[model samples]
Target: MTRMVLGAGTGLAVAGCSREASALMDDYATVSQAANEPVAGLTLDNSQLMGIREAGLQRRVSGFLSREWSDHFVTLDNGAILVDINARALHYWSEDERTYKIYPVSVPLSEDLTRTGKTSVVQKREGPDWRPTPNMLKRNPSLPAYVGPGPENPLGTHALYLGWQYYRIHGTNDTRKIGRKSSNGCIGLYNEHIAELFGMAQVGTQVLII
Candidate 1:
């Protein structure tokens, strides 16, 4: 598993340990070999590395699905979002395609911070401002009371608020954090991927976080 240390303050910059850093070296090699086959003259960079990591995480999630839920990859709703916390990935069921596409995501680093079971989208927001909850403030008193939308905002550019208490499928400014367990409780995805997902999802869309 990837181990990372969360920095203090509002933005929560992620810093990995030596083990993770070493694993990332292997990740670069694996991603580069795959890229060479599909795209000529393609080299792996930090951005691409993150994408590769997401894809790798998705594969692991797929393996789990194959073993446990062979017939289903998402919620019963055609437009639902299924979150696999154990695999640190989110599967978005595309209505038009009639299939699910997995995306790398960040979940609560500690199991205690995460909640499981079914929910639905209650609200959605673009360029959402982030307000540190009381528990978050308790953990990090130095954190700002509120952060407006911008690079520093943890909620990124879009947020799909869930029916569960204080949980949402949101974007993050820190793309590197994706594929790692780092969120306070909510699900975190790359801003670009979230932008795509935000458009497909709607109010009352089912969400199952397992």
Candidate 2:
């Protein structure tokens, strides 16, 4: 899927509620219909790609095929789309960019919104203390220990603060929920996973929440 930023007033620019808007809507309908036209499954030699009888070759994810953000998310190699959502898990498949693959991101259900320019500060620490800030205490009102790097520290190593105090994407003493939802606004990942992401993402990587 192509990731297009819907700028403010873009709707107005595309078409208005007046005659122009109706015309624009018609054009959109046409384009949408064409794009939705069914095309046979991906194939190699005029035959289904999965039908090929080759060693170590077979389509693993065979279920619902839908359009989504993976559409238009062009691969860096040939500017082709990359699909990240599938039944298996958060997958990234880059067409044309034969060398790149997508990874899964376990975003927490933080108490914050995923907005643009919502900066993230990464702090790396092992056995980092979980000092309950005054605000955090106000929210929980019964948080224990409230301080010191310990087993219960909420601010796991490599904290990505989102200006929303007490909210972050940090490491976890619990590794079971690395790829699932189980956090309070802060994204949880395996230590090695965050470490890898930290190295790849720069200080200002755009974190889009679709």
Candidate 3:
């Protein structure tokens, strides 16, 4: 198996626009060529190397392995979404198995703030409002009670409400958080990515966070 170094700064930054996406494609193309060569330090295995190449094909920014729906779900009836917290990536598969997409994401800031298990998309909202959860307010008393839809809103352009209370898979105005551990118990995507996902996902979509 091929092995490559996992340097601290080794990661891909995905931009939210097509032009930037093209640039990332070029960058990944250059990196993929080196996948088979062994690197001298802390290394990742062949599967990870393949993921880097697979991510490039989708024209999305991702720094983790691609996932298979069969590995997490028995059926993709209403479509399925798999949020891999450790990978900081979200995998989606259409009900017909005709569409698959992966997006870089932001996960909970700490283990205590994270909740993992099965859930479903209970609601889908465009221009969604933002209100810090009660626990969020307790941690930061200065937090506002409500925020309307707009660029300033923390929820960004769209949101997919999960079956779990106070949890959601939503867009972020703060793009810097993607591919990092930076959410408050929720998963976050780029505003553009979430908007696209919002259009593709439905209320009954299955979700599995692992």
Candidate 4:
């Protein structure tokens, strides 16, 4: 996996609500196995290219499939979110079970950075600020000490902080990161998707990453 270095100097431009947003939503609604392939015309490093190829192979060999909400949780009391790392997708179920949504996501760059298990949303923020993790700083000493809420902020428009420290389900200013292995650790969604999720998800919502 290739590390997507996030630094203060990195100028991440927000796509806002555009045609790409609609396309992303459509892609999520009818995600195919081939959706895991690298985006066309998107430049990737050698490691990233290799990772995508391996991921493609793994998907073929395992016949990667989506699971039902009941497969992981007995109930969806306050709603539930399942982050499928292998599929690079996020599944959401409404508390009343009247609504279910699936969104493409960006997972951790590598397995070492990924954490899988049950956790819950502990905090929610709109226009969230960002600070690089200590390890992120150590890996890239040039990263800014802090980034305020704005288009440049990597956290995008909304963030749902999980029970696990430093782990979050958040939006990204750089839409290209979605549906790819690009995040340092957090699971990333499109800004529009996260905004919708933010409106639906409560702080106590259950989350399972697998």
Task: Residues 35-81, candidate 1: write the lDDT tens digits.
Answer: 11111112333454455355443243232231212234453554767
- Find the 10 residues in a row with the least total lDDT in model 2: 7-16
Backbone clash pairs for candidate 3 read none
Model 1, residue 84: C-alpha shift (Å): 0.5
Span of ten consecutive residues with least summed lDDT in model 1:
31-40
- Lowest summed-lDDT stretch of 10 residues in model 3? 27-36
Indicate the TM-score of model 2.
Answer: 0.42
Clashing pairs in 1: none
Best by TM-score: 3
lDDT of 2 by residue, 100-143 (tens): 22332334433252222233343434455565556445766655
lDDT of each: 0.62, 0.35, 0.70, 0.70
Look at candidate 1 and tell me the lDDT of residue 27: 23
**Which lDDT tens digits does candidate 4 get at residues 94-183?**
899877666667788788989999999999999999888888878767666887887677787999999999999998766766666777
Model 1 score (lDDT): 0.62
**Angstrom error at residue 166, model 2:** 3.5
lDDT digits (tens) for residues 124-184 of candidate 3: 9999988878887787676668778876676778999999998999987655566667768
Residue 104, candidate 1: Cα error in Å is 0.5
